[model samples]
Target: MTPVLDPDTSLWHVIALEVQRQRIAHDLSVTQLATRLRVDRSTVSRIEHGWRKLSPEQADGLDAMWDLQHLFRRLVRFAAATDDGNWFTGLMDFEKEASLHRMWEALLVPGLLQTPDYARAMISTKSADVEAGLETRLARQASVFDGERAPRVSVILNWAAIEQCVGGRDVMRGQLAHLLEMGERPNVNIRVMERDAGAHVGLDGSFRLLTISDREIAYSASPERGRLVLEASDVHDYAVRYDLISNLASPVGASRRLIEQALEA
Candidate 1:
């Protein structure tokens, strides 16, 4: 038997294809599988296409249905861990299949739209073992626009991010300009939360919520805590926090003016 590919290394598209193949071999139509899984046919299709992630319970069901108990266990473990390498690999899987990405940045601009100069400055300040962080950052951004499945992203940045001037005047200016350009895209949305905004949960740090179909996963950074991956209940909490932050954030039109003002200043 050929060795089974590690789901972490395989693209999400490939994973979905394998799932579809197994379902077919078992003589299961989408509706039939959905009935067994207690979900809608479209939900089954989304899972098979990697447009939705399997929760732990769903993974267990899949394992029994496909005789993949071991593989499913490994996938659940991978999802629960904080390994940056593994986390990034999983992110690549989602990036390949996700239809939308919703993110909140309290510290700096999110990685996907960072300019090279801005990226270098941010990476230079980090103590991470990873060298060429800037290069990797750029590559991730390129991936977003590279293919047909390019994610529709909505990013909310804190007003303080613009005021902090991570890379000084020239670089900050360029970054703001880049944000302006990226915001013009049909699939991208940019907003800013003002300092005066009262009581928002995301004031602590940056977090991202990636959506595939209707399933969402949350990720956050920590020093002692490391990378935190939240699903199910935790995912819902973070989503609520995101909504609160967005409510207090500047509107899109106002956010544009604020960026313009920062550029002028």
Candidate 2:
């Protein structure tokens, strides 16, 4: 079954209304629609009321039988993209809408840059459904970061994060190589901050700053919690800190050189 959509988003209302409109237009009662779709009447009722989820197969059946022009199929994707968590939804939405994105990492490779093996090793250890979380993250890279029109991106990695050996040797090497490959893209700038730089403003934490529409927002996540920075002052502070840390990190060319060196090791 597809996941429930966040009612906070207008898309949720649109989908519910669409389903109801289709049923009424066809002069079909909830029971008739449910029977036609081979689902329980309660399922059809829940879909119209936005209380339960409609499975993708069932949605496609609705679309095919009702001649929805693939509308339900598309709406199913929107519902699948959302879940019941505030932690990932906000930043993900910002990423979709943002034109520019910058991030710094002190402990582990940033999610956007991780290889599947590395990401699987990390996320599976934390979440109940490791495969689901891992695939979701990988899917985000394709949908949000891989295109030419994707957000102009920059990332600074602490030397320790690169050297810590999170997923063992082979996975780490693949990840490093992937970094160099992604860095070659015009829109992606990946850098490494040598521990030698020692004691910079970013010592406080890792944060991500994004340019959304005309405004800037920042986010910080820790093992304990995550924070969304909305105040202009706070967002500016992170941007300033990012600039300082980027200065400390090796420049793109030298950064790729560092990654190459690590790949050799």
Candidate 3:
């Protein structure tokens, strides 16, 4: 039995399958389709396998070649623009699929790195069912951090987020210890923004920049709502903001020392 592709999880997979289907229906070989799209045959294969996304130029070429009057173009546009509003389904999909994740958190530890107790303390106050919420939060970490090919993650954590005790001394100490362990992983980098750094763009809120397939996405969250940003320009701005905030953060070694100091304090 063939498994079904979930469009909500990855619109790229849906688009890829559709392009392959269109090519087959038109009796075009992969090489021939590549020629039409002005991309390499490997590019075509990558697109079909959902390892790569169709660029706007490739989308336009497909529409022109098929004379389908912008069918592919519209799919690409919609895929880039699609978001799930408050549900954050789209944001979660991006987090799972992204090859690289860059995050800046001002008020608390990012969910991807939160400890179970810390997550419970945070989630319990805002929502019902602490056990269910804690389970879900831990599941999210497993998906993103425990994968065979875990994504490279770089985090800029505000020092205040560490000093502010959420779950009590034991919980805070455990969380900081966890952070140190995670930082030791080759794929993870943790940099701390000292509380004294005083006033920066990241102070506006917490956000993430995710690099997935051929594009970058930005996600910003408020109390109960989140937004997935796909506009190239907007995503670029987030990238730039991340760079600026990173400038204010301690180096990885220094950050580790800071965490250790906090742990001993």
Q: Among these predicted structures, which one has the highest TM-score?
A: 3
Estimate the lDDT of model 3. Answer: 0.86
Task: Report the number of the highest-lDDT candidate.
Answer: 3
Runs in model 2 with CA error above 4 Å?
Answer: 1-85
> lDDT per residue, candidate 1, 171-197, as tens digits?
999999989888888899999998788
Task: List ranges where model 3 is wrong by over 4 Å.
Answer: 1-87
List the RMSD of every prediction in angstroms.
Answer: 10.3, 8.3, 10.0
In order, candidate lDDTs are 0.75, 0.81, 0.86
Clash number by candidate, in order: 0, 0, 0
Collision pairs in model 3: none
Candidate 2, residue 25: Cα displacement in angstroms equals 38
lDDT for position 238 in model 3? 92
